[model samples]
Target: ESPNDHINSHSINNSINVISDDDVAMEDVIDADDSAAKHEQIIVKWICQRCTLVNSEHSDRCDVCSSPR
Candidate 1:
């Protein structure tokens, strides 16, 4: 009859320990892809042939994916 009698922390610890290096690598790749996908405003207009993503024509890089022109 104690206040702490009904706590289930065993499963939580097991789950935390189950994460593998592959999971971490996949997460990093996803994060990198996401970051590379963020748009940066460009003053000039440009076109992306691969993705159809547009940017400033005078811009050296694509705003949507950072692809070099």
Candidate 2:
């Protein structure tokens, strides 16, 4: 086989592996969503010092001004 043919086959194999990995990740995401729906998540609100924009507690920076929290 030519070098080009070998490279093409290798890339095709890699793509197949990536697709399978993505399928597994999707299943995990679905499971996580189901568990999340079963629980109540508390989201704390924070006000930005510079822009006075209200942001979620999970965020490290202000959404409007991009100021660090």
Candidate 3:
């Protein structure tokens, strides 16, 4: 196999590995709402009451779901 072919097969093997470290990490990752209560770093962010998506204090609407603040 050419050098390029070896690299392609290695990448394909890595992609096909379901139990890869990256896949495990992605599965363990917590979403915004899940960590929102734990990570209260942003005290000034305007939390949209409608969608609960956080936005800048200056914003008049939610940045994620686009609900009016």
Candidate 4:
């Protein structure tokens, strides 16, 4: 191919590569956000009504009598 054609093709290829890299980075960021949200949802809190005791942030039941929160 002619020099000008070769240069244009290389430029186009570089542009495509840059765009693909950006898309991958953006996807990685979105995945991280989704993972953080899932972790937050999995953490449950329990507060005892009788003695007013707050259990661990990850506990689903009160520590005193195992009552559902």
Per model, how many backbone clashes are there? 7, 0, 0, 0
lDDT of each: 0.44, 0.49, 0.46, 0.42
Rank the candidate models, highest lDDT first: 2, 3, 1, 4
lDDT of 1 at 53: 64
Candidate 1 segments whose C-alpha is farther than 4 A from its true place: 1-44
- Candidate 2 lDDT, 1-69, residue by residue in tens: 677865543344222111122112111221332333332233356677788776766789888889988
Each prediction's RMSD to truth = 16.3, 13.3, 13.7, 17.9
Q: For model 1, how does the per-residue alpha-carbon lDDT over 22-50 read when each residue is reduced to its tens digit?
A: 11211122123233443322233446655
- True-structure lDDT of candidate 2: 0.49
Query: lDDT score of model 1?
Result: 0.44
Order the candidate numbers by TM-score, best to worst: 2, 3, 1, 4
Q: Tens digit of lDDT per residue, candidate 3, span 1-69?
A: 677856533244222111123112111232343333332122345566777655666787778887876
For model 4, residues 6-63, the per-residue Cα lDDT tens digits are 5533244222111122112111221332333321123234456656565666666678
Better of 3 and 4 by TM-score: 3
Each candidate structure's TM-score, on Cα atoms with residue i matched to residue i, is 0.30, 0.37, 0.34, 0.29
Cα lDDT, model 2, residue 22: 11
Candidate 1, residue 62: the lDDT equals 70
lDDT agreement of model 4 with the native:
0.42
Select the stronger candidate by lDDT from 1 and 3: 3
